[model samples]
Target chain A: MSELLHRRTVVKELLKKRGDMVVIGGLGAPAWDITAAGDHDNNFPLWGAMGAAAMIGLGLALAQPKRRVLVVTGDGEMLMALGALATIAVQKPKNLSIVVLDNEHYGETGMQRTHTGYGVDMAGMAKAAGFARTMNITAQKDVLRLRPLIDGMRGPLFAQVKIDAEKLPLVLPPREASYIKNRMRISILGPEAALHQ
Target chain B: MTTVSKAAKPAARAAARRPRVAAPRPAPAAPKPVMPAGTSHWAEQVHPMLVEAGIRQVGLVPDAGHSRLIQLCEADKSMRIVRLTTEEEGVALLAGAWLGGEKGVLLMQSSGVGNCINMLSLPVACSMPLLILVTMRGDHGEFNAAQVPMGDSTQAVLEAVGVLVKRADIAADVPEMVSSGLRLAFNTFRPVAILIGQRVSGAKDFRKLTQPAGDINE
Candidate 1:
């Protein structure tokens, strides 16, 4: 398996163990691949939807303290709403987990260079902003190493996964966008039974 | 004769002593007007308005015009007032608040309205509820030239974004407008703008109130 798919597979397996409110961002085909495998419910677009998912997750976690909120984000999109991390840190929702897919490019935006290309430490930033737990995984083996850490985390957590940009799969054009948007709305608002239909 | 003179002198002295003055009568005590203590304070008037509207989260952009309202929100524990670096940041913050299940309001000035035009697209596209409290800046004899362009177009821009805009030019209109805007925001699950005219916000002097320095920070 390619490095991108392998890392996604490991992350997906880890996420399946935890039952939480998960919001997936439009990173690349990996996010779509994971969602296709029925790993998460809500899949939000990341154009203007970047910083909002985490904030919404923070709110949901605060309102429903018994449940956890996990956000699957991309490096480019995360930078757009970086200040929100500081706000989240101050709020310190223990049930929040932010997983950043750092391929070092805006793969959705035609593979443009993002701040991550300038050697920005996305996980370190989250940690400095006050996330109690943080990790950076560069290999599929290290991705597997996160199972224990993800299981043991009690508060806000951040994880950055570095994968080969060229290895990440490209989703088929316009159809994928519509499918993700429709599926996300269904995930957020519709019954789980209706999702399969 | 000497005995008779002593009795007469004593009685005369008692009679001439200015009728025993009665402690000068305390100058009629100025009839201290029956003004209710704490009623004149703005916090008393504004805090209840926020509570009654159920406004728990407020995203603020600093403005001299909104100083009083901001102060009121800051003093209130029930209301979480977040000060943003820019007006658009405040709009984005409110959008997050809406998605998170908390109702939010943006507090800014007319000039800041210009800064928020681009960011308004997020709410419009997402179909989220936003309640914005705007202090009017440019029109109605504004002294500042910088505020003119945005102040003139505030209503038009808001209307273009599908936001229902209400103007409170008079003091009597403020409370009802705020309450109505809050209701509409929650009911419609879309943003609403309440514009407080310059005369209303500018007429009041907040500095004279002797507010505690650490009230807002806390």
Candidate 2:
């Protein structure tokens, strides 16, 4: 009902001063948003794999339990893989957090209305799926509140932040998937382990 | 002609003398080759093989043929098993695991292959090592017609997505195929799928399942 928060600003705040946190962006706009925040080796923004951001976060969380894992995705991408919510709940990775930038429309597909636009509740679904914590963040001020939870919250935390549906300029990540993967691998695992692939 | 006849007569006389000792009885029929009694499922054999390969994460959508392997992975303290709601999640999950410096495997059935088609691109494009162990459902005496299409198409579909496909038609060959597939995937940073043929992992017979417990003929 009120003015929606800007997606880029929200992403910038979430990823500000990110240290060793593994960030996965869902396909399309979320990928662009994370790239807009700042393209770092730690950031793996998907050029594709529409519904897989959360599951990737879950795997990273499980693999490196000490490092925080964050997934930022759009409402459409999240809807495509709702079952991943259940899977993440069962795994209960304490280091994992998922943030949905709910624009209520498929921003990439010409702004067609998605289920979120018709009143689907992403946070409620996550809560019901047994996330340790869930939130529906609609206010700009609340964006600041998510930083601490993402960094240290006893997680499997889920948050659905409603963003404006207005299309913004694209901030693209590396086009080569191999380059993206290897760069992150080198950053996290060092050249010795990341070499070859 | 006289010399040739004489040589033939001597050779025939020697053979008759050697065998006249009494016709040796035919050797007793060798027993049919059969697996040892109480042998465990091939998945049991493959579980340890996975551990040996340094597989730290396992993403799985449960299958009857993989039941033993899943149980083994769950019990092992060193391994982490994530149960997927659909087979496709494993694709992304394993990719993430590799990014975090861990080796992961995916376990699914043949029908689940369709669910993973689009997601397979993640590994292909990224050149991440992905090893998938598939238990076939619709081959070799398949009872459920619904599984046929995907089961038959599993190899072709995976191959089309740039995955190297292998098959294990006999239980004895399953562990070896899995080992080779793992090596091929991880060493080369390629996506590999090993199809566990229905012959090796028996197909689920719906008719037998629907029958009452006491009505089972076997």
Candidate 3:
């Protein structure tokens, strides 16, 4: 393995100035990574449904065209629904960014090697799919450079952040999908959210 | 339990006037303007309802039963259609759409409904407004035995997973059936399934199908 980067540090840095952004975390490790970064009311962390993180982000970006949307998923999770990259690129929502925390394994299912480890270039695939910005970052400085593009640039951005393939402490978000969803909804829409339509 | 949309009530939309989704596909070999005779009008009637309700996102796992509806969505610029490789993605996609202040519908067939079973937990648990339109196969003179099992069990399976099921066996009943399903989904913030009977789609001609009997044997 060529000098693996740390997943937590990558996620934490991406979400550093995450003001009013709606973040969707893919099922397993990425969900844990977001919780580790510190759960917020705007975070919709998936406890199940393996390959939906990116498409969900696309829908949210389309619905709230002004609000920035970010999806954080793992390589295994990203690989499961790579077709979504094309779909997101087709819709081309400028406020959306999809980041794959590539540890090169399915951390939740057992540390089995994923396609990325075998040299499946996800950033290249995103670029081919027509994302405005695509990057495969291995170093912290590159991630630092990427932070501004994710935060400030007008984009349908896709980034694959390569991280160390190692086990980390589980920081599970609230498993109740309803509570998490409603909390996020209430945060974005206010207390009168449910009462309205 | 409810999320009112911030969507502007754009002037009374005509079936002819397209609003958004700049035609993505290159017009495929001069399109036919007419609907085929004997084709189910289920999609014709329901497509407008979705538009009226401001459901602009349409997701599907293509099925012969929903061919016309899919075509209608593609033609109707008001809807942004996402053709999914699998049916489960629709559930997550629609949930995300609703949370972001828009409405969506998922169109699939009975066999594809089975693929969505586990993912149903997302809408049920989150109380997301999920509108599912499933065209029924394997019921009433099913030519293929493979479709029979899931077709018969679809309603029960959907119900067991907490989705309220509605059936529209006749073309005339399709509008009311779909409208009720929409009301149940958005007003009450529940997931509702509307099953379109094969009687409305008519049975496919196995003899005309080019696929030989040996091609799909397990």
Candidate 4:
């Protein structure tokens, strides 16, 4: 199976289990998968999301305080604003989970090597920057290992998932109409109420 | 004999009188004061200037040259010093801070400039303002060859990206230049660069505070 497919499956399952989570990605595979997932009640865009994913999650977390916020990030997207991790750490949001898909390259941009190739320790770096929990998962088996840790996570968590670089078939349509509908649904129903669906 | 006595008495009386005392001179007006000796870490002065200029967020990548400014920012609550893993990350943080209605500055060495070239697009694309305080590393008598290339390229690269660059050769120029750069950055909503010359921060031992505390606890 393709890495992208694995990622999409994992994300779908995670979202199915834990609803109302914010899945943010740049304009590429992750976004495509999110767009394929179709709209939840919330009308927010699932693809081509920019640097504000974690930040928006931060705002939501701060506003609700009791709700959980999951930010699905890409390696390229996360590199654009890595300092957001430090800011999140400082805030110490108890219900925030940041999952970075570390393909080691900007898959959207012709698969160029990012800093991850230079032995940049993203997990260690996050921990040193004050994240409460940091982990790295390379295989599908390890994804299950993270389930328990992510389940009982009390504070901000940073999980770097390493995946093989292989293209996957487009799972969702490009129009993003369904994602927009989900965003709208979530807005009207509220994060909590929307998650119950 | 009486006239002689009278003259002698008059002379005696005149001599007995004390000569008019010179009016006690008021202590000479204190000389105009001067800036105290050894009170001139450019970083120390720049820290307060940044605070006064409303730059509350400072993102730093540990560089020996920026030690003083980093320590100063760390000690200040009004200014939060976020230590970044890379110079580019620092730049991004500053950009985010700008978006959130807060002003930010990045302090790093010149070599780190290489790490920041690609990330520089964030400000240019978003129309967000950024203020970077870069320490010169390679040019003036630098022992590290790795720093020379970026040091040479720093100004041109930043200028190429539409960022206005200013050089502060002396310690005193830092405050005014930082203040002016910040104003211009906000007014134009563009990134600005203030490059600190090697001599300004290079020679100083900034690990310890120059001023001694009156009380240890305080």
Give lDDT: candidate 1, residue B86: 54
TM-score of each candidate structure, all chains considered together: 0.70, 0.90, 0.83, 0.60
Tell me the deviation in Å of residue A38 in model 1: 2.3
TM-score: model 3 vs. ground truth = 0.83
* Top candidate, metric DockQ: 2
lDDT of 2 by residue, A68-175 (tens): 999999999999999999999998989999999998998888889999888999899999999999999999888999989989849999999999888888999989
Model 3, runs deviating above 4 Å: B1-40, B75-77, B209-218
TM-score of 2: 0.90
lDDT of 3 by residue, A101-131 (tens): 9988888877988898899999999999999
Better of 1 and 2 by DockQ: 2
Residue B49 shift from truth in candidate 4, angstroms:
3.1
TM-score of candidate 4 versus the correct structure, residues matched by position: 0.60
List residue ranges in candidate 1 displaced over 4 A: A1-7, A24-34, A37-47, A145-154, A167-197, B1-46, B87-96, B139-144, B203-218
How many Å off is the CA of B142 in candidate 4? 3.4
Task: Tell me the lDDT of candidate 4.
Answer: 0.66
DockQ of each: 0.09, 0.59, 0.37, 0.04
Give the lowest summed-lDDT range of ten residues in model 1 chain A. A170-179
Higher-DockQ candidate of 3 and 4: 3
- Tens digit of lDDT per residue, candidate 1, span A82-176? 77677667767787777777778877668888888889997898899899888887767767766556555477888888765655554322334
Q: Per-residue CA lDDT of candidate 2, range B40-62, in tens?
A: 67777788888888999999999
C-alpha-based local distance difference test score of model 3: 0.85
